[model samples]
Target: MAGSIEIAGLGKTYREPVLDGLDLTIGGGVFALLGPNGAGKTTLVSILTTLIRPSTGSAHILGVDVVREPGAVRQLIAATGQNTTLDEYLTGRENLVMFGRLRGLGRRSRGRADELLAQFGLEQAGPRMVSTYSGGMRRRLDLAASLVTQPAVLFLDEPTTGLDPVARRSVWSDVRRLADDGTTVFLTTQTLDEAEALADRIAVLRAGRIVADGTVAELTATVGGQRLVLLDHDGTEVRSIDTDGTAASLDAALGAVPDAERALRATLRSPTLDDAFVALTQSATDHQEAVA
Candidate 1:
């Protein structure tokens, strides 16, 4: 089973403080740590992965104290940073085998690496240097390398950042497989759809603080009033929402007032994840600079 993570009063500073008394508890399959650029997302993951130390607060990962037992914490966690961690000079298979050996695995690690390469659809490219891999392929390899020992807690810092849709979905599939095997995944993503699609719970960080936290539905509802949407035959939905709930109100407005619902056949009638993200993650700075 995956272990729980408890973080209390997490604070970090770089030139300026990034995290300020951030508190969070995560214990589940997939936890999406959401934030925009420079929102301390990377910094938070760094501390959790023992790559950096937090200035303050206590964090426990899998019952190990990150501050006091960093090495222990590292051993329990597998991480794929926002940037590629694969060595461009080494073949994909080599990278995996190297990590496995680093984890103290012996010659048997080669067989295991080959299995992962095939599983990730990189079997054909396994022997090629990572320099020849595409962004998506590299991302997949990075993720695969992290799962070498089947770690309990996995940290993926924007794993799908530069991948194509199909490639992104492939990465997501691998992540789901890991989570289903009872790995606790802490993911950071700028893509709201990725968060909504994969995260069991999500937390929003802005200006070095958690502005919101909850499941996708909960966070969206907590932030925005309501939304109106027009959907296409192919299940494509376009939403428009305001603080006044105009987007949603209009859809129901005519129906309520005139008692006639529009004949929108097979149209999705929910707010897209993007609308919810803006509402939940947008800060006072956004509010004040709203195209005025």
Candidate 2:
């Protein structure tokens, strides 16, 4: 277990309950927490990062009890929140060095920070005030700050919330790099595509509880309907199918078009992660409504 997180019967409430006995366990490697807004994803991140105490239950980071030994857990984890809190007056490089110093890595070289600046494509912006940096640049710098300590675990809350495609892609590369270096990455994002691309496994959180948890393919296969695909080798100018999917129905449709056999091929594949997200979120919404 290079880096591990075990949350059991975790609960949180502020006026109304946010979590209800949510449980999760992860050790090492990149894991994605996928959810929509108001789904308690941030709440889970806050507690797991030791920013706040849970209402009940226990959470362990790197085998250290978060509630009983917060300091020790903090030592093993770093979080890059959605909001970038870089000092406006400080240059990007200055901020990174400041963080590295705070981590008590003073004697250690800041050559790593310089390399990170270049790696994040912020070399030109290194000397500029955080106020002068673009949203994407500041986001990258915030992420860079988190890596100064080389923590065992890193929590990223929607790391690409406010970035362009190019900048977001660059940030994604950095995330992969960190995971490759043996850092256990806990990420939350609204972009299903992002989760599917990077996460070795994904846990869907809704109403502060994990409604679905598994590898992208596994979760998709849970609620994802059997996909029936028809390949038209003729490259027909127009093609359509009935909305209802049934073996008998498809067989009838194919039989009616027997003459088109040479140009048509049909196959079935399981559902995709995108479909799982929608299904999980919708189910959560229904649960919330019933609770209310």
**Per-structure clash totals for the candidates:** 3, 0
Model 1 Cα lDDT, one tens digit per residue, 148-184: 8989899999999989999999888889888999999
TM-score of every prediction relative to native: 0.84, 0.83
lDDT, candidate 2, 187-252, per-residue tens: 999999889878998999887788888888789777635544566666542233331357786676
Count backbone overlaps in model 1. Answer: 3
- Candidate 2's C-alpha runs over 4 A off are 1-3, 107-109, 227-246, 249-270, 284-292
Where model 1 places Cα greater than 4 Å from the true spot, the runs are: 1-3, 228-270, 284-292
- The CA lDDT of each predicted structure is 0.82, 0.81
